[model samples]
Target: MDITDNLAAVRRKKLSRRAFNRTLLSAGVGMVATPLIGTRQVVAQETEQGTIFTWGGYDVGELYTSYEAANGALPNFAIFGGTEEALTKMRGGFTPDIAHPCNAGLKRWVDTGMFQPIDTSRLSNWGDVIPELVAMDGNDAGDGQPWLAPFDWGGTSITYRTDLFELEEEESWDMLWDKRYAGQLGSLASGGDAWWCGAIKAGVPFGEIATDEAFEKISAAMREQRPLIRVYTDDTTTLEQALSSGEMAAAMTWNSSAVALASEGIPVRFARPKEGALTWVCGLMVHKDAPNLDKAYEIIDSLLSVEAGKFMINDYGYGHSNAKSFDQFDAQTLVGLGLSKDPGDILSAGHFMIPQSQEWETRMNETFEMIKAGF
Candidate 1:
């Protein structure tokens, strides 16, 4: 089935008691039988390996190896393109101990019963994580339990070639829709973030706008700019190639990818325009029926530990929600990651990716598809 079809199926299943009861029963059995249940009968703290699903560059395998060396086991990792794709996989029965999805996408995952409640009490560093990251209904399991551990976040900003576009002369969201750059612009290919850029360019609020009219407006805007699109891609490597070769003179991009392309001497520059950005925060959440829950928390603890956050900040140029990571990394490192000693500036400017109602999401996807088809 197509994504729309799959989404419909998920909605139907969520409303079906047979499916819900089966899931509940499975979770109950898994909780009781697995080593994760802290009951006296189950070995809650046993050493074991777990599987993790995440986006590329988020999991530096060496970190897992180090955790394994210290803790007697490691997590097997898998990478995904986006949250929608990850959720689609879960619905199709692709199981992993943990899946990394952004905060905005959590409601769908939680509503579908894809994840288990987190044992926040067992996590050594749970309290150290920024409270704002977990400040959501899905942070806890459907059963009033904590479901996920928060991770690094970043923004969807305008990444233009400074050498290609004069910065002092050109600094606006207009760079993306500029007719002058016809056949030389790029954007995210995935539906959610792609439409997010379209909405922002069309003057729609990133977090609000719950109507079909808003979707149509954004879709029309994207359609108008469609001819100018050089490529619609999810791969940063492809975007870097486009930027370097001038296949794309300018584009909407994630901050880390822009920084990486820029640092390569490709003359790229990132900007948060007056219209703001489509930002997102990703975190690790375990499946309720995961085969290995203890190992999952171990993976979470290791990844969210101050050391891992520092590594992510320094190596990847992505911002971490861990407030203490700044103390662990130097000023130069923090600057590279776009983190300030004072984080309030970051919070003030950043937009959280929010989960709109599924009905709106469906309409948004349909509108985007129509625009892309016409293109």
Candidate 2:
């Protein structure tokens, strides 16, 4: 079935929180079991090697070619819908050598005491990784060691069908809430991204987003825009399909969706919102009680290599953390993709979602859920 058909079919079934979280990060559609790479027998035998608990589609062998070449096998893989769920599972005795979490959740993850500091010296490519990403809000743990290794970076913006929506003004977040497009707009279902997008529309600066007044204003704006949305889903594939079929005039989406849609010959544009886009950086962390420490470091190093970075930018449409990765893509291609050779420039033009307390996160998510349900 096509992506739209798959989304329609999946919507008929009840989606669990875990499934929603996974789809949120990976930007994938449909419900499927956690993909276990390699065979069960191989996984069982490779238990001595490391296992990575991460977002779906990230376990691809190409991203870890070096590790596979050395060990003659791939690491066992597990999947989690979100960082909190993964942290909960780890606290309850589910151990994986490494886990992936974004900068917005790094503080909370570190507070859980589930991850140990990364020894950059052990990662051969560490020297070439972008310094700006290395210096992001939560990368450092206040000690000499760092907690998170910079990986994929990208923006969140409006993806619209150029053939459907004529821009009266420059592209802006207001497009998503325009009354003219009521019943034809879509948005991301998760607050992790949607809330920040709302903040941008509300003109609430990123640093002030946690204040009571900011919350009130942002909440009101989201509620006002709610009726205009035809669908609120975490599935980027579905969003792309809807745009391709002219089912949705505009939707909030990540950079990857725009690339995917355009590559398929869809006349779509990934907007550089007038208020600026929402940007983020996500990466890997080793478990505090990791069993295969050496292999875990190797896995991280491989992911930081230029080869892996090329795969990420060209295939996944994300900006890699390695500065050298930009060498593979020409200047025009980077500009067309809304990326800069230096990730800092892109981040500076946009607002980066910051870490929030678990309590605040809970309340924001709960409030967003109510708004989505028309409460």
98-159 per-residue lDDT for model 2 (tens digits): 99888888888888888899998899999998888888776677666789998889999999
| Regions of model 2 farther than 4 Å from truth | 1-43, 46-48
Error of 1 at 69 (Å): 2.2
Candidate 1 stretches with Cα past 4 Å from truth are 1-48, 71-73, 137-145, 167-170, 330-336
- What's the TM-score of each model vs. the native? 0.81, 0.86
lDDT minimum window of 10 residues, candidate 2: 29-38
Count steric clashes of candidate 2: 1
Error of 2 at 36 (Å): 20
Error of 1 at 75 (Å): 1.7
Query: Which has the greatest TM-score?
Result: 2
Candidate 1 achieves a global lDDT of 0.73
lDDT of 1 by residue, 1-375 (tens): 212333465767753656557667967998778764455433333224687888887666644644686666556667889766777888898788888877667777777777777878877777778876677545765454566677877778788887776554546677888888898889888777888777777887765666667766887888888888888888888887888888888887787777788678777777767777666777888888888777787888878777777766666667776788778777775666566665556655766566766677667777777777774
Return the TM-score for candidate 2, rounded to 2 decimals: 0.86
